[model samples]
Target: MKLKTLVGTFALAALPASMSFAWADAAPEMTDAERAQAKQIYFERCAGCHGVLRKGATGKNLEPHWTKTLQDGNKVEGGTLKLGTNRLERIIAYGTDGGMVNYDDILSEKEINLMARYIQQTPDAPPEFSLKDMRDSWKLIVPKDKRPTRQMNKINLQNVFAVTLRDAGKLALIDGDTHKIWKVLDTGYAVHISRLSASGRYVYTVGRDGLTTIIDMWFEEPTTVASVRLGSDARSVDVSKFKGYEDKYLIGGTYWPPQYSIMDGETLEPIKIVSTRGQTVDGEYHPEPRVASIVASMTKPEWVVNVKETGQILLVDYTDLKNLKTTTIESAKFLHDGGWDGSKRYFMVAANASNKVAAVDTKTGKLAALVDTAKIPHPGRGANFIHPQYGPVWATGHLGDAVVSLISTPSEEAKYAKYKGNNWKVVQELKMPGAGNLFVKTHPKSTHFWADAPMNPEREVAESVYVFDMGDLDKAPVQLNVAKDSGLPETTAVRRAVQPEYNLAGDEVWISLWGGKTDQSAIVIYDDKTLKLKKVITDPAVVTPTGKFNVFNTMHDVY
Candidate 1:
């Protein structure tokens, strides 16, 4: 049992029974450098939704048996929980209608009472990365017949951009027709999503520290030919975009062993790991159900996969990964991130703690609607558009509502058959001047739709970026400060503009000014027909720049 002592014995079996005599009777109210600065602010903002063994998928279970459970059944000698510490510091300074974000404008009240007494202490356990520790952290490094088969780089693999240099574990690869920076590399750690390979000549990425990599933009400088590691946290990755499997299998998912893996799209190897725990689609029993947002179904070689704490979507079937059928379906509950509707046959997603969105269809693999949205929502790949008067909608954006809803998607043409009686319904909400939001984009030859609150904590709506007007969806959007159009220099901390994308000639949009990691970040771009600011892209290796994508709209996932 030495896979680093079996991941430190599964993080000490995720501590519970008197976690060290309740942290030795709450160790003198915090002093070992304030519990090491509250475990580095719970590993940079609460271990990505209450985890690192606090065992809750998409947030909530701060263990110590539910954050110290105490309506007075006596506990709190450091195992603090009768929901106290002023109701978990007012749910970490006002934020939690589930999509949890109001760190009272980014933590302070002494870092939200030191992360509400650091999740009521007792939660360290972080080591189990098995699958022979991801095949002993695999690495190939340039092997598909020593790479470069064709385009040995004149760079413009459909306007290359894949930026996510998040917390500098790196990815950069810029140059969307020379907005510059073209290659940063070294990944895995906050890389979250990049995924291209439907013959965009490989990009892949996927990291919240589960690594993944791949790269090879027909080399001669694009590099990193292969890499692996899909456990110990991860976000999502795709690849096998059907049509005789273009990149031939890749998958990924993970947020800590709630499994997904499936490799070898071009030698990252590990072929199959599955396990998205059990029960949930509300049938209960979910021991961290996660495998959130996977996609890859351009009309089925199958992979829809969602699952966040078991709202169960699955579909899977990679044409027999040694006989693997799948097809689960059930919807709603924390699912997270979505897209594909201007008829890529449905597929929606965001169950964001159940404010619901769910969709599916993928050409009738079923569960096609769920709908009802607003609070939380957070649709990272959402925005489908064609709606001057609601004739094929699909939009999302919310972290606890302020509007942008949209919906309506279902059609058999005939000029959208009078809006098909508002198909999956909700038609229009739009509003937004607030609410946290995480991506909403749009561009099928544009008319403007973009969203992005960068998880709003307000510093002028998280450094602004709204822009509606698909010929006026009842007006009112054009916000745009994008950190004052990224001319950068306004820090009261929130330098977050975040992901807009669109360029394979949608005449520019780009965005990402996400600052911090020695802040200076920039990507801005704009000008999608006079929405203005066309290019700011500051450098010093444009460090913390989150999500950019666009290798021809992420090899045609298009949102």
Candidate 2:
């Protein structure tokens, strides 16, 4: 693709010195139509990894230049590194080996060319989202008093699975027992995660577009009762789950504006807004330090908020919003999603770029340990189970390496005392054929550990999943070709398998077969003990199935 030459020498020069002030005033190199289209494309695809402010996290920072202010009011400029339009276009079109998806087919040649030039100009900054903004955006679809007082459907609520239908901006709640689509409701675009409330009655979904929806399952058919917009882009959300505070409040973390907000869990009313902009653990001010992930504490009435750029884990006390108290625990930067350990006391999260796993002792409100691991650990809520040698261990898969690192975790039980010496260390690294893994999962009752390599560039490896025997860690993982098993015609796009979820009984495991929007997508179910294909759910509504959240498993914090 031919492009206009951008005059810059620095690496990925995405902006000029005065972009913050002149973005609206200056006429850009691209037309208004090109600029608006590129902005939408970046928010939906690039912002989650590169960040809304162009600060890098799971991906590289796309900022054009760096500036520093001296103590005496003098400004210093850093060395410039500009990725010219030619290089930028190729990288965006062909993608990188670092798990970035190539957009050659997804975007037209003209659109791809437009993006290359768009990044070369000053990136447009979004307007600040305030408390009044959230209040104005809030919508109470169904009144609380008008809702069902009891279970109105015969479907087992505990075994229902909230399936994210990507690209369609909808969610399909499937019955795990009958393997049928119970209901399909319109939702936010590219719903990132489906979080079940403490009571398993309300399903909360936070999308890439920052739209949060609460689905009430007690109705005859599952219905979206409330919804709200957090910002232009967001990822994680969790309901308060403590003993006395179950489903009272919800917390959401956003990629843009670098902040988190609290809302009423039942009505989706906005409560407060707190910005996460701060200095990194390295003691340098970062403009776009975002809240990467959030999970509610089982024991304490607090939320563990992971700040990506700042490398800070904030223990936010939700009990007092007016005088909010937060205990910040410093760890490694590039923090992403994670879950509780076997005992639910230590929360283990991946600091992806740091090549480390940070365990926070929620009981003590302190940083427990940071264990070094293989490259780019991408553990989506991680897996926790008993290892024959390590006793209780949490498992994480890597995107940059073909290994699943199992780290020993502490347990208070006398039966696990012998394995205490191996605590907070990588006990084993199970081998796989390739990397680019996104999620690894296991259940308390199941004897198998499931991991997916959805991000791998190779079609064969990307469309396959591996199951490790918990009883014998030395045995090779059982690789299942999910795409072949689906019996769907092969397309040019690789149908990647991702996000393995288990039923309430842990007897069945479900995997989402993620493909292109036009390509047919499916959810493949397998028997846990036999490792045999049990069911393949393919329908017009199942377009680009990505994440599946089992109600019982998610509500109870089962890995």
| lDDT (tens digit, per residue) of candidate 2 on 20-119 | 4212222227878878999998887888887777767787666543211112322225432324455676667766656565677577788888877776
lDDT of 1 at 392: 80
- List model 1 lDDT by residue over 1-559, tens digit each: 1121112212212345654422223412667788888886786677777667676655666765445435543443444334546566666665554446556545679878877776777777666566777878888877777666698878878888888878878888888887888778888877888888877888888878688888888866888877888887788988787788777788888867788878778887887787888998668786667677797888878888887877888888888898888988888766877888888888888887668888889887999789887777877888786877778888888876678898888878798898787889887798988777888888878888989787654567767888888897788888988888777787645687887888898989988888667768888888888888878978888887888888888777776
How far in Å is the alpha carbon of 379 misplaced in model 1? 25
Q: Write down the TM-score for model 2.
A: 0.91
Off by over 4 Å in 2: 1-28, 65-82
Give one clash count per candidate, in the order shown: 3, 7
The whole-model C-alpha lDDT of candidate 1 against the native structure comes to 0.77
Alpha-carbon RMSD, each predicted model: 23.5, 5.7
Weakest 10 consecutive residues of candidate 1 by summed lDDT: 1-10
Model 1: what TM-score? 0.32
